[model samples]
Target: MSKRRIYWTLQIIGWSVLIMFEYVPYVLEYGFDWDNFYNALINIVLGIILTHTYRLVIRKWNWSSLPLPSLGFRVVVSALVLGLIMALINQPLDRHTLEQNLLDQPLVFWGYVLSWWKSLLAWMLSYTVYHYLEQTRLADYEKIMLTMSMREAEAKVLRSQLNPHFTFNALNSIRALVYEDPAKAQIGITQLSNILRNSLLADRRKTVDLQEELRTVEDYLELEKVRYEDRLQYKILADPHTVYWQVPPMMLQTLVENGIKHGVAKEMGGGFVELSSEIVDDVLLIIIRNSGRLTSTESTSSESGGVGLKNTAERLSVLYGKGASFRIFQEDEKTVRSEVRVPTMSENPVISAKEIRSF
Candidate 1:
């Protein structure tokens, strides 16, 4: 039910119980007294209206934001005032007694205030618990929305970086082919078009299935192969069971571009590019191998230091923290390897994005 409806329902039930408790004793003691019933009805109605009005005032001033000690003092003062009002409202019922004057019997007057004070304090405690729980839930919901927005924004920046790097290299190859081979250049344009369309889709999503990322990478590699011709040979190996796991879009494509730019394309013989994916111990492991010698200045050089590797590292850290890792090093003099490992998680993953506000 809505909060407004719940508030009114509890209000009615609470006041109804208070009214019954007051009037039932009078009915049992003196067979049917309209005077006693009238006082009980009026007292209950005034108590409900006054307490609800006080509640509205507390909400208007946002008293819940106050420090614990200040809030407790305010609640006690309000309850004491409400209890005094209830004692005054029920005063006419005591006119026939020996201690008829509150001025003469001050102890009796304090006894009524003390009884009502306990009842009002209980109501205050109930309201405090409900208000605190509601504040906690609102805080959690805002946190989730903030995290989703940040991840979407970071993904966009990473894709933007990768797209230009891939396109510049592809267009460069196409420019050279135009004078040497017109027919192949035309085909390269078509492959580039197809790859860009897939990239546009990837740019719009935070994550896509592993199969979709692999397909986009294959399209990219196909465009590269048109330029490398007889020198570039590639192999892709993937476990069928790992196809549906979610991965950052275009991640593999960026890695493949990085490998070719630094490794295979620079080699004289232009050896094979090997890409593989496997699931081991609840981790999705991707290995990209290419033929090139590892050099000391590879990462430090401004010209060859493409944004792909750096973006990959940032994205992995943002998305999975300790659960993901990206590393690139030379396996041997003839072969350099880039390896990535991310937790093999299912769909509808709940990630705690609180610590990753840097992105």
Candidate 2:
């Protein structure tokens, strides 16, 4: 239910309870007379009006933001004023019964006001706690939404960065091949078209199928293979069961592209670039091994080197938190390996606006 509806419902129920307290006793003794009925009406009005006015004040001032000592002091002052106002309004409506006690108006007013101290304290305590919790819950919800939006925005920017860098490298490779082997360059152009099309279709998604990603990587490797001729050799090996697994879009391509640029292309005789995936105990294990000596030059190299790898790693961390890992290390003097372990999802995870509302 909406906050306004809930607030009004509580108001109605609270005032009804106050009316019942006075009306029930009067009906038991006087047998349902109009004088008692009217007196009860006055009491109900007194409770609802005074308390609701106080609610307006609380909302206007945003009392929940006040320090504890200040809020407590205000609550006490409000309750005392509310009690005095209620007593003055209620006294005239039932002065006949009240006068038999020989009480002056001042003493009578004090008695009614003091009588409300406990009830006011209870009401204010309940209201303050409820308001504070509601505000906290709303604040937490907004914070979570902001964080999710920021992560999504960051992911989009990283994915966008990958495309241009990958495109530039692919075109550069294809440019070299066009003069050396025009026939192979034609084939590379076709592959590059297919790769670009697939990336565009899946660009907005957080994840894509491993099979589709592998095809994009193959297209990239094909372009590189044309330039290197017999020097560059590569293979994509995966279990059939693992092919349909959901993974970050363009992730495998970025890794494979990095391996080709930094590893095989730099060597005298181009080396093999291998893409492999296997699932062990529900965990998807992806390994990319490429031929190169590990030079710690990844950071100061191309923007795609430091930025791309770091972007991929950060994306993995964002998607899987501590549940996923990415690492690069030298396997031998002639090979460098990148390993990724992430929880396997049968299909891409989808989140909707409605689902995000509560968070």
Question: Can you give the lDDT of residue 264 in candidate 1?
Answer: 83
Reference-based lDDT, each prediction:
0.77, 0.79
Residue pairs clashing, model 1? none
Q: For model 1, where is the 10-residue window of minimal lDDT? A: 350-359
Q: Candidate 2 lDDT (Cα, whole model)? A: 0.79
Model 2 CA deviation exceeding 4 Å by range: 1-3, 93-108, 176-183, 201-203, 299-304, 344-359
Instruction: Write one digit per residue (lDDT tens) for candidate 1, span 151-227.
Output: 66876887787777777777876777788888987887887887777778867776789888787778778778877
